[model samples]
Target: MTNTNSTKTIAVYGATGHTGGYLLAELRRRELTPVLVGRDADRLRTAATAADLADADIRVASLDDHDALVAAFRDADVVISSLPAYVDHGEAVLSAAIDADAHYTDLSGEQLFVRRVFEDYSARAEAAGITLVPAVTDSNLPGDLLGHLTSRRVDGAAEITISHHSRSGGDGSRGSAETVLASVDWFREGGWHYADSGWQTGRPPVAELRYPTEQPRPASKFPLTPVLTIPRHSAVSSVTGLLPTEFHEGLKKLTADVVAALPATPDPASDLHYDLVVDAEGSGKSVRGVLSGLDSYRDSALMAVEAAVRLAENTTKPGALAAAEAFDATDFLDALAPHGITWRIEEL
Candidate 1:
C-alpha cells in the first residue's frame, strides 16, 4: 500500500455518488491520494471537501467523451469506479482505463455488464497490459472468492450454489435503488446461471437456501455476477445464485415513479448486513463457505479500494479477471477480517 508520499495515483470514477464518497474516504484513510474524476465539477468539489481532500486533484470527464475520460485517467496507476448501474454506464470508463494504460476495478453487480467486461474487453485489456476486474462489491466478491475456496476443498465441485441475504436499516441508497430498477427486467426473470454446457436463463425450481439456524427457504435464481465470473477461472460446471423470490416479485412491480421518490443516499446511522453463502458439493462430500459483513455499501468501498491498491502493486495477471482470479482467495478474504467482513469454510 502506498503511503502519503507515494507517487501512485488512484483515479476514482463517479466521485460524486453516495458510494463514491465512501471510496474517497477509504482511499484517504489508507494514506493514498485519489484523483476525483466525474461528470460534474461542482459535485466533485463537494465530494472532495467531504472527504477532507480539498486539495486532491479533480478531473471533469463525462462518460460520453471517450477522449476526455482517457485524459482523466492518464496519470492514474489504477482506476476504481464506484458508479451505480454499470450495465448502463461501465464500458466507457473501462475502455478509457485501458486506453490510459491504467489497471481497473469497479463495484459492479450487473451480470450482463460483468459478462461483457470479460467477453468484450478481455482481449483488449490483455493486449493493453492492464487488468479490468468488474463486480467487486459485496454482492459478488465474497461469493466468487468463496466459490473458489470451497470448490477446491471438495477436490473440485461439480455443483456450486450461492445464496445472498441482505438487511438494511431502511431503503438503500438511490444508486442501489436505481441499479435494481434499471435491471429489474432481467433480474426478475432469473438472470443467467451456469449449467453443464453454458450460461442459461431460468434454470429450474426455486432455489432452496439454508441460512444459519433457519429452515430452508425458496429463493429465486437471480443474476448473481459470480455465475459469470467463477466459470472464467474455476472449473465449476454448474453455478446458481439464490435471492428471495419475493424480491424479484417486488421488482416486477417497481417503477420509475416509485424509485424517483427514494432518498438520494443512505442515512448516517443506517446499518446494512450482508451474507454470501457458498455450497460446494462433489465426491460425496460438501464444503460450505459463509462470508458475512456489515454495511454493503461501506464494505464494497473497502473491497474496490483494496483491489485498486493490490492491482497498483502490479502483481496480478493482466486481463479481465475475477477477484479470486487476480488474488489469492484465502489471503484476500482473510484481509477483510479487520473491516468487519469474515469468511469461514466448514465441512457439511
Candidate 2:
C-alpha cells in the first residue's frame, strides 16, 4: 500500500476495455500518472474521467499508425498493453514501445503471443535497452515464478507440472468472453510443452496432481502458458500445463451470444479468485509452489503495473523475458502480498 508515485507516467493502450478500467485505477491508486492511449478518443476520455485522472494525459493512437503509437508512448516510463486479444493486436504496440524507448509489459495469456515476444523481439528490445515482459498475468507469472522456486528446492527440476484453478463470482468481462471465443481454434490444441530436450506437441508427460485437499481429477490437456514461459528462465528439462476438464469445456461453450450477454467491465460486486500451482520433481525429491489471489482481472492489472514499475527501475533482465527472468521472483511475489496474494513452497 505504500507504493505510490506521481512522477512516473504509464501509458495504457486499450484503456477502455474491461481490464483497462481496473488497470487505470491501480495506477492512480499508486499515485502513478496514467496516459490513456487508444484508437477511440471518446472512449479514452470516458475512461480517464472515470478513473479521476483529471491531470493525466490522453493520447489517441491506433495500433496501425506506427508514428502515432510511438508518439503516444514517448512520454511514458512504461507502457501497459491492455488489449483483450494480444495475438491479434499485440505486435504493433510492442514494436512502438521499443521505438518510443519505453519499457513494456502486457496482459497477454496466449502462448503464441508470449512466445512471439521472446523469439522476435528479444534482440530488438535488448538493443533498445528496454525490457519487454509478456504474459505476466495470473496465468503465466505466478506459475513461472513458483516453478522457479519449486525447482530450486530439488537439485534441479527434471520436469515441472502446472495447473490453473480459477473461480469467478459472476458473469465476467465481455472482452474476456470475446477473446476466449475468438481463440477457440488453437487455444484447445494444448500449445507447446518442453520435453525430451526441446519443445513438443501432442501428449506431454504430466504427473498426476493432488493439490492440497483436492483429489486428482480429469484435467483437459491444454496449453499451460507456463509451459512456454518457465523453461525460458528455469533449468527445467520438461514442463507441462493443464486445466480442469470442466474449465476446458466451459471455454468451448463461451459463444458470441454469451459474450454479448456478459458485462462490459467486471462487476464491482462480483468476486474473483485464482490459484496457480506448480509441482517440480527431480533428484528424488518433489516440491510444490502455490500462488493464490483474488479478482483475476484486477490482480492482473496489479501484476502488469508492478512489472511496468519494476521495469521502469531498469533492474530487470534486459530484453524480452519471462516473469522470473524479468524480476527477482521471490521479491516480486512477496511485494504482492498486501494485494491478497499468498504464496509458499514446500517439499513432499
Candidate 3:
C-alpha cells in the first residue's frame, strides 16, 4: 500500500454494487486505479473483473467490523461508498474514512441521511482534517447547483424553488430502490425548508410550472435532497423542490412494496434525462434557470470521481458539506459536459 499523500489511492466501499461498478469504471477511465473494499471478496473480485480492474487491490471488511474497515481505508487518500440505505450502512464506512483521515463522498439521496452525516460527522471530520460530502450525484447536486447559481443572479434572493424531472431509459438499480424504501419516514413526515430566519418543517405546496421543454409540465412539491443541500451555501430563506405527482406516488408505492427488487443496474447505454429548473424570488426581483443532463448514473459517477480527485489533491475543504459548498458548482457541472450533461442559466 502507498502512503496516503504519496499516491491517489481511492478506496471504494460496496464496490460490488451496481453504482459502485460505474464508479470503478469511471475511476479507471480517468487512468486512476481504486482499491475495492466490500464485505464479499468474491463479489468484489467479480465486479473488479467487469470494471477491468482485475489486478486492483480488493479489501474485505463488513460494516460491523469497525477496525477492519478503518484498516481497509487507512492508506487511501479518498473513499467513495455506494452503500445503499445510508442510514443503515453508511455510518460505519464514514467512521472508517474519518479514522483513516481520508476524504469521503457517497451516493446518498435520502434527505435525513444527508442531514445526519453533516449533523453527526461534521465536527469529527473537521477535527480530523478530513472532508465528508454526500449526495454528490445526479439525484441532488444538480438541483442544488442550479439553485445556488440562480440565487446569485437575483440580489437578496429571499426564497427559491427547484423543480426536478428525470426519465431513465431503464429501471433503477437495486441499491437506489433500497434507498427509496428507506426514505419512507422522510416522505411521510415531510422535510425541512429554510424560512422565517430559520429552518422549518412542513410539506411544500404543489405548483405547476413550465420547463424548458416546449410544453408546460405537471409539477408538484416533493422532498428531494436539494431542500437540505441548497441552504448550505445560498442565502435564500426558503428552498423547495418539486417532482411529478405520479412519480412521487410511485415512490410511495415502492416504499410499501419495499421487497420488490429493482434491476441490478441501469443499461450502460441507457440515457438518463433530467430537467432542473430553479426560480429565485426576492423583495422585488426574480430569476430563473434550467439545467438539462443526460445519463444520470454516468454523470453521478463522474461527479463523485471528480470530487474524489479534487479532495485527494487538497483542492477542497475539510468537514461535512454539500457538493456546492465543497467545490465550485459551475465548474463541477461544466466538467461533466464531455459525459453528456449540459446546463444554462438566464434571468427572467
Superposed by TM-score, candidate 2 places the C-alpha of residue 78 at a distance from the truth, in angstroms, of 0.8
Mind giving the per-residue lDDT tens digits that candidate 1 earns over 1-348? 222335689999987887888899999999887899988889899999999996789899999999999999998999998777888888999999999999999999888888899889999999888898889988698889998888888765458888877765235888887887778888878789998768998756654788766678767888889888888777787998888666776786688888888888877666578788999988888889998998888899999998898898888888899888898888888889998898899998
The candidate that wins on lDDT is: 1
Candidate 2: tens digits of C-alpha lDDT, residues 95-140:
9999998889998888778889989999999988888888878868
Off by more than 4 A, model 3: 1-6, 169-171, 255-258, 267-271
Ranking by lDDT: 1, 2, 3
Against the reference, the lDDT scores of all candidates come to 0.85, 0.81, 0.78
C-alpha displacement of 46 in model 2, angstroms? 1.7
RMSD of each: 2.3, 3.2, 2.3
- lDDT, candidate 2, equals 0.81
* Candidate 3 lDDT, 1-348, residue by residue in tens: 235455588999977776677898998898788988888999999998999986789899999999999999998988998877887777899999999878998877777788889889999999988998888877587778887788887768458887766665225677777776676656645566666766677765655766675466666666678888787788887887766666666655664355464556765555568777788888777787776777666677778888888878866778898888988888988887887777888766
TM-score of 2: 0.92
The superposed Cα distance between candidate 1 and the true structure at residue 291, in angstroms, equals 1.0
